[model samples]
Target: MTDEDRYELLGEIGRGAGGVIYRARDRDLGRDVAFKLLRREGSTLDARVRFVAEAQIPAQLEHPNIIPIHDVGRTRDGSLFYVMKLVQGQTLKEHLNGRTSRSELLFAMLQVARGIAFAHHRGVIHRDLKPSNVMIGLFGEVLILDWGLARPTRGLSTARDEHGGTMTLDGDVLGSLGYMAPEQARGEVHRQGPPTDVHAFGGVLYELLTGRPPRHSRTLGELIPRLNELPEPAPGPLGALASRCLAPEPGARPQSGEELLALLERVT
Candidate 1:
């Protein structure tokens, strides 16, 4: 059936370079769905391609932590769009507006890490890992969102990603500046992989501890100098863990989600 025939557009809930997310309803199934419509005008070919990956990548991985995809198709206007389960809680960004107890923070982070690990097991590398893209459901389900920049690891490929010559992620700084790893910010796609994601996850952990992004210094000029400042010998265990993850060299950081989860569990 056609997109319009199946889902009714209720209203816009969010917007990003990938496209607009509408709070839609599946007429036949009688349930709410988040619909992302790829913009036709003002969208470059790469953006459209990433929009396809954003719709498809996450749909391939079936984990409780990864947002699930329900349907995908083109609209009557020939615009690409996809439907996914509607989350009912705030983003990790919104949820982190203020600090919570240490235990609560660690629990949420562990779940987030588990989700990342699950994706990694499926050969998916979430190049963009940040609080804004992570949704914490009302029932405490932590979901990783936005797979537009995600890439396949060695010996892995998805049906949607292989649809055309569109599998290669951009060599530009295709991730959120503040949360990106140094290599990612440098547009060195060749050096990007699991370590890149771990470093960014460390940045997230740092944010959780300090309530500020560790990579706040954006540009290389500012970031390089600030990295020299070091973390000032970490005030506590959590701080130390974050410090390890935020190390300038990706190799020095936790290499895998499992390793991170184990280390963070010890500190927690």
Candidate 2:
């Protein structure tokens, strides 16, 4: 049986620029899973490589806060697909819709920091970090999702495909606008590192404390100049930390997710 035959697609969960994710059932195991299939049409070669790396990278990480990949294969139609645990919960963005408990929000953000710390320990960096990418399960479990932009931090600064071609070219900006670190917004791919995610962690925390993101700019150009102009967060330690994370210089922020986790632990 082929990869597609082994799983039954129940319905589509969502769609993104790279591909669509479906709710599927594993025929052999009789278990429900999330099947992400790459877009066959209009997908560039770089996107394809990143899609495959997304699956491969997370599979190597066995952290409780990170989504786990169950299987990966190509469909009979030649489309790349991967199966992962089907988490039942709303994203942190959605979860914060009607919630206002500071402690609860801090707990969720702490879990996200733990996950990112583990990935950094494994020599990988999550270039994209935002509340939307964080899922809070029905049982209060926090899991980080969508690692399609992750890259190794060992020897190279920028990610490269098997053929050694740069996957994220210089000046090829990626990541969400408000959550992006200043270096990321400028498309300084080489400057991206653990500090990059720390900046985003601050943005997430700022949004949790305030109703909006740290930066209110609607476009990259608008955001660049106003990167340092952050709205005041909740009046406390958490708020203070958020401001530190949003510092324009990467050195001014926590050096890594590990450092961020440590700092967050001090917040009561």
Candidate 3:
């Protein structure tokens, strides 16, 4: 069957700054799948490279909690496209809209921690861990979405744009503002190691527990200092652990994602 005959293009599922995701079905496979079509219409060389990087990353990583790559292909006009198992669930952000029991939320985040820890062990830093990137399915399965920003840190320098912020060189910010670490926002290449993911994870947990990030600064300058000075609102040992993870100094944060996962499991 042809493109039109093989898959019916259902409406978009989510729109990110980098790509537009659609809910489509595979006629051959007889199942629903999500297609992330790269927006390369007016992209520069660097942007195209990053888009290809995103496609390769997910294809490489195979984990139960991570969305499974079904297929990677291109359109007749040359747009980059890839398919993944269409997750049936709401984003963690959506799940937090109403009141829910604390036990239920902790259980949900625990799965996220496990997934991140697993990915970190494989030398993949999510770089973009936020509520919207987490999908909670009906059977309590958590799927980490969009490995688009994941970078292999073997020797390649942290990518950046002209403005000195973390970017793909084509000048698009890879992650969302509210969830990005201070160093990531400054375009400081040296400071964007795995610990940056730890900091973002802390922000996600903070938002889950308290309904807001620990630091609410509207700008990068405003956010960095507040990370050190202000105390997190999360109660008990979890609050202390989160504070350590969100420390302004990257070295002061957890040494690895596994360490942070251990702390979270110990607390809840």
Q: List TM-scores for all candidates, in order.
A: 0.91, 0.94, 0.86
Query: What TM-score number comes out for model 3?
Result: 0.86
State the local distance difference test value for candidate 3: 0.73
Point to the candidate with the largest lDDT. 2
List the candidate 3 regions with Cα displacement exceeding 4 Å: 1-5, 155-174, 219-228
TM-score of 1: 0.91
lDDT of 2: 0.85
Following a full C-alpha superposition, what root-mean-square deviation does model 3 have from the true structure?
3.9
Worst 10 residues of 1 by lDDT: 224-233
1-268 in candidate 3: lDDT tens per residue?
Answer: 6553566678898776677889997888788888878765876656555666666666666777787887776777777777888888788888877565678777888888877787778777778888888888988788888776776665323323222433453232346666777677666766677788898888888877678866666766665555456444577787777777778778988867888899898988
Q: Mind giving the per-residue lDDT tens digits that candidate 1 earns over 1-268?
A: 7667899999999996678999999999999999989867787766777777777788878888899999888877878888999998888888778555657666888888888888777777898899998988888888899988888775455544466655444534677766777777766777777778887887888887777787566555566455434454346888888788777777888887778878887887
Error of 1 at 260 (Å): 1.5
Assess each prediction's global lDDT (C-alpha) against the native: 0.79, 0.85, 0.73
lDDT by residue (9-76, candidate 2, tens digit) is 99999999868999999999999999999956777778877887888788888999999999988887
